[model samples]
Target chain A: MTALLVSVIAAATPLLLAALGALLVEKVAVLNLGVEGMMLMGAIAGFAVAHSTGNLPLALLAAIAAGMALALLFAVLTLTLQANQTASGLALTIFGRGFSALVGAGYVGIAAPTLPRIAIPGLSDLPFVGPVLFGHDPLVYFALALVGAVAWFLYRTHAGLILRAIGDQHDAAHVLGYKVVRIRYAVVLFGGAMAGLAGAYMSLSYTPLWTQDMIAGRGWVALALVTFAAWRPFWVMIGAWLFGGIMYLALYMQALGVPVPTALLSALPYLGTIFVLVLISRDARRIRLHRPAMLGRPFSAGG
Target chain B: MLSLSPRGTASEFWRYAAPLLALALTALITGAIFAFMGRPPLLTVTTFLVTPLLAPGGWEALLVKAAPLVLMAVGLSIAYRANVWNIGAEGQYTLGALAAGGLALALPDAPGWAIYPALMLAGLLGGVAYASLVAWLRTSFNANEILTSLMLAYVAQYLLVYLVTGPWRDPDGFGFPQTALFSDAASGPRLVEGSNLHLGLIIAPLIALAAWLVLNRSVLGFQFRVFGQAPRAARFAGFNENRLIWLAMAISGGLAGLAGMFEVTGTQGQLTINLGPGYGFTAIIVGFLGRLNPLGVVPAGLLLALTYLGGDAAQMNLGLSSAITGIFQGILLFCLLGSDVLITHRLRWRVRA
Candidate 1:
């Protein structure tokens, strides 16, 4: 049980980070499907940098920058040029995969230094919960803190309100003098940074090894989680944990001789994601309860 | 100097020229990539793009590879035209192969002529059945077909892995993740004795012809196109959105399944894990690159197949990594997308006051 908790937290960290980033982007009315590509690039960049410099912080920063760079490309095409968001997002994924492979070709099968764990004094000593919650690496704590920070920003701050208003109705926000394009730019870049950080965590902390296609559709899951969470930061956390828990459960069940087919077990988490999407989508009201009106639609300032 | 204007005749040419222009740009970018890897750019380009077509059996390989892509793309074009995104052709393809493989396994001793037709039917039915899940979910519960289809693909992959690793493991062979080598009767008969090209290549063109007929000549095609262009207009015209959704998905699924059936019988000759190397996904690009035209898919499919062949050649001869191919493919798509910008809006040079 304790082991299961640790595993779930570990799995959830990447998703949590990516979801928070996606939540921010969606909050700004930009649905960037490039998260998968951004994360993959981050994974490769982070791993390559960490392996070379032997400095974890610098590697992570580089990864975040790499992710942001990729996100900027997406912003240029989709946000500035007003390209189709869905097609551009798919293009980014393809670009990232190819670019990462091309750039990181020489670095395949290489390993990176594992992130050092940071233990909270009193909390770390508490039996099972402490080790699972308090006893963890810096990135895991950062992921949790991000959820709180994002929630506070979105619901508490004036800037958050402006961002939400823009997402709700871009033209209306434009008429009201809310620098809609600029705010979107900031939010999209912020989202990119977080997604990059998540990808960095996958390599430097979670797996501590680099492989081709290492992100392995986690970005898509993050996208789905944002929808599953109904675009709320708190629910995003729950959704991440739920997905992580499903993943851990599948692995645990296999270890426990559950007699489930290995293939089914492997696909369980994806199945859970799909099933959750169906459940949430069935309630049209629930699905539309918090959607930004202009999500997935490009905004042209004067047009 | 000609004054740059936002609206110009040249701009229109540039817009339509984007796809072709993107291909040129991709070539330049890939040439640099080859140089960076210490390979001769000219030699690498030839091997990556031209050499694949010049090899002795190149035409045959191209036809074989083009078969599934043309079929899948033609079907997907229908859904795409109707604004239905079915990203799960990979899953449908897997299911089709499984069905066809199952049928082949069941009738190991069947006559050659009867076996192939039965396999093709099983493959078609398999695809339709898997696709119906997406249709049912979308119509009954309003689920997003994109997510459902994608998730189903993973399930289908898992199913393939389980079967190949477990019950389907060949008894006579060494323990490997592959089924028994199918008999000649179960395999797709070659159109040419010395090449892998099979009846599926012929089938692909026929499928394209039928797709063209349906898309251009049929009322259903008109409805689908209308629904795609304007959903509200379609509804006003008394077109059923639900029925259109089913039709789009069914055709897409059936074509993808056919691709898989041909792959198993014609090329691999046995069911195995990793049967598809993202062909279904890549075909999405092919579908768009071909402008969703069934006839256009022939060239688009062959072009993509060339990439696979060239990628392999680069890996062997130039010592370039296999990923260089993906990089080239990515660049092509990116350039194409970037070029498409000209289609809707003109780039004008404006003077700052």
Candidate 2:
């Protein structure tokens, strides 16, 4: 049971990070549907860098850079060029998948140095709770810390107020002299960085190797997590952990030789996402109150 | 600084010219990618765009490939026009094939005439049923169809995998994940003596024409247009949003299903795990490229089909990743969106204030 709990936390870490990033983007009224693509780019970039340089931090940085590059392209197209956010985002995902495949072709099957777990001295030695709480890679702790930081930044800061103002009413925020486009750009880039870090965690710690579509549909799941949280940071963590638990539970079922079909097990995450989305979106008032009003809308200063 | 200014009236000239311009831009960008990959750019570009058309029976093969895309895109264009997004046509297509192909395998002794038509109808019904889930969810529970439909697609894909690997696996063949070869009677007739092109080649255009008629000449089509262009006005005019959503999803899902049926009987000769190669997703691009008109989808489908064949050629000749097709497809969509912006807005040189 302790082992199962440990694996569940490991599984949830990447999702938690990605969801946190998406939460920031949502807070700024920018709906980026290309999180999957950005994650793919990060996976390959991280893998390639790790394989060549054998430097974990550099590889993670490279992954962040690759994700940011893709996010910048998306921002330019949807935010600056005023392209349809949905189509452009879908395009970004397609392009990122193909581009990542191209980049990671030679790196396939090459193993990279996995991150070492940080074991807290006394806490990690304390029986069942120790391994669950104190024995994890630094990324897991970083993810947890970042969540709290994000919660604080979003609720307790001046910049956070401005971001919420922009998201709640972009036109009004624009009239109030906030640089809507620039702020959105910054938040989107930050989101990309978090997503990239999440991808790095996948290649460097989760599985510790490069594979085609290694990120799978985690990016999409993270997008769903944002919606499932009703755009709240605290709920986003719980949602991510819940989904992470579901995924791990499926694996545990297969490992125990459960008669459930593997295909069905593979589909649990996506199905769970759909189910959660429905539950969250059922109340019109909840959606209207919580969802960023200017989300996915193209803004023009002159207008 | 360069800034975009909204036009009082969109330039009609750029509206038509944008796709052509985007096509050129995509070709140039993809050609550069080819060059980066250490392949001859011009040759690669020609291999993608020109070489396929030059080969013998290439046009026939192109038509065969385009049939599914055109069929699916026609439905998608109609739905998109109605402001309903059904991204899970892939799942609908899969269920359609399973429904139709399952019939053939289940009733091998049935007469061909009865089985084929019945299979097609079953396929169509399967698609409608699958898509109706999205309509029901959106109307009854207020779920976003995009995520729900997409999730359903993954579910359908897994379901197909399970069927092929389990109950549907052909017993007589060496252990392989595929159904039995469809009986000769159930197979679609070839359009020509030598080519693999099936009767679907004929049916695709006919469906496109019928769709065109409905979109242009029917009250339902007008409702679709009004809703897509102006949701508030559509509501004010008393058009039922829920009803329109159901209608759009049904039409799109039904056509996608028929496309899947044709693909199984016409192309594959049997259902397999790889029945769909993202045709459902690609058709979305085709719908947008064709200006969301059924008639326009015909040529748009052919152009996309050309890229698929070209991707195969580039893989063989240039040793490029088949993912190049996805890259080019994505580039085209991006370019299309960029060019489309110019239709309603004009770029001007503005000094930083």
Candidate 3:
């Protein structure tokens, strides 16, 4: 049971981090669909750095930087040049995939430098509950902390209110003398950094290796999670855990020598993503209330 | 400091020049990447762009790749114009192959004349079947088509893998994850005597031409345009939103499937795990590069097809990573998206913040 809990957390961390980042960007009414690409770039960068330097900290930083660089490109295209947000985001993801593959060619098959677990002395030595709660690496703790932080910043703070205001009505925010584009830029970068962190977690800890498309459709699943959670931060964690459980359930079923085909088992996560999205999106009123008004719509300051 | 200000009207000149600008910029950046990779920058870039054409049978090969890309892009352009983001053409393509391939395998003794039309029709229906799932979800449950379609893409890919590796594994072959070489009848009539180019090469452009007429001349096309530009206005005009969504997905999905069938019949000769070489995704770039114009997809597809050839050539000649092709494609797309900014806005000199 403890082992199952640990595995679930391992799978859920990356998704939660990515979805949380996307949640913030959505809160600001800017949808960056390049999460997959950014995560790939981050994965490659993180893997490369960690493999070479053996310094997990530097690797994490490189991963974050890689993701931020891609986000900056999205911001420049969608916010500065006023390009279509959907196209620009797609471009970012495509570019990230290509570039990551090219750069990571040399790093294939290399075992990544694993992230260290924080053994909190006596507390970590505790029985079943300790490994379930306190046995995770720093990233798991950081991800849980991030949820609280994101929720507080979004609900309790002045800046968060402004960000939500921009999401609800950017034109009104602009008339009120708020820098809509500038705020979006910052939010986008933060989102990128989080995606980067998630990518780093994948390479350095979760699976601990660099492979082409290692993120698979987790990036897309994370996007679905945002909708599943109704764009809320805490709900994102819950959704991530649920998705993680669903994803692992397939693998476990396969491990137990279930009668299902392996290919079908592998496809379960993606199919599950579609199912969850249908469930969440079936309620028209709920989505309308939670979805940012300007989501996927390009905002032009010049207008 | 430089800044951009809105233009009262979009720049007509840039609308035409942006692709050219993007091309030049792509070359420059990718060239720099070549240098960074420890290859001779100019020579490598030269080989990437020029070697494929210089290679014997290059033009034929280019057409072979371009035909299917243009076909899928034609459908995608229509969908995009309608503001329907059916990015899962790749999955639809896989289903088309599975459907067509299934029929081909079943009718071993089927006559050529009957088999060809049967395969083609099966491919079309197969794609429509997959795309309708996306359309139904969006129209009924209000699910985001982008996510559903993409998620389904993964499912379709897995299904293909399952068949090829498990059920469809070639019995005569030594444990390879491929179906038996499709019978001689399954291979469609070849167009070029020495190359793999087939009937689809001719069919793709004709379809694109037909699409051009429909998109430019038909009332349905006008509805697509209006819905894309202003959804509220379209709703006010009494357009059936659900119907438009269904039509858009069907058209794009059908074309994608046909392209898949062409790939198996024309080039692959049998269904295999390696059947889809990312043509579905590349067609997205083709659709955009052509300015989402059906007539424009032909040239744009040729250009993208060249990149695939160049990537192959560079891999063999320069010993550079074959991923260079993917990198080049990504950078080229970025430049195109970036340069498109000039079409609607002009850069101005700003002295002070």
Most DockQ-accurate candidate: 3
- Model 3 off-target regions past 4 Å? A125-127, B350-353
Best by TM-score: 3
Model 2 chain A is weakest, by summed lDDT over 10 consecutive residues, at A94-103
- Worst ten-residue run, lDDT, model 3 chain A? A294-303
Error of 3 at A215 (Å): 0.7
Candidate 3 has an lDDT of: 0.90
Candidate ordering by lDDT (highest first) = 3, 2, 1
lDDT of 3 at A71: 97
TM-score of chain A of 1: 0.97
lDDT of 3 at B131: 98
* Candidates, ranked, TM-score: 3, 2, 1
Clashing pairs in 3: none
lDDT-superior candidate, 1 or 3: 3
lDDT by residue for model 3 over A1-303, one digit each (tens)?
898988888899999999999999999988888999999999999999998899989999999999999999999888887777888888888888888988898999968679998977898889987898789899899998999999999999998899999999998899999999899999999999999989999989988899998999788888899999998999999999998898789889999999989999999998888888999899999999888898876776656
Against the true structure, candidate 1 reaches a TM-score of 0.95
lDDT for each residue of candidate 2 in B103-123, tens digit (9 for 90 to 100): 889988888778878888988
- Give the alpha carbon lDDT tens digit for every residue of A179-297 in model 2: 99999999999888888888889988998888878887898889888888888888888998899898998888889889988988888888888888888888978888898988988
Q: Quote each prediction's TM-score.
A: 0.95, 0.97, 0.98
Between 2 and 3, whose DockQ is larger? 3
Best candidate according to lDDT:
3
DockQ, each predicted model: 0.66, 0.77, 0.86
Q: For candidate 1, what is the total of clashing residue pairs? A: 0
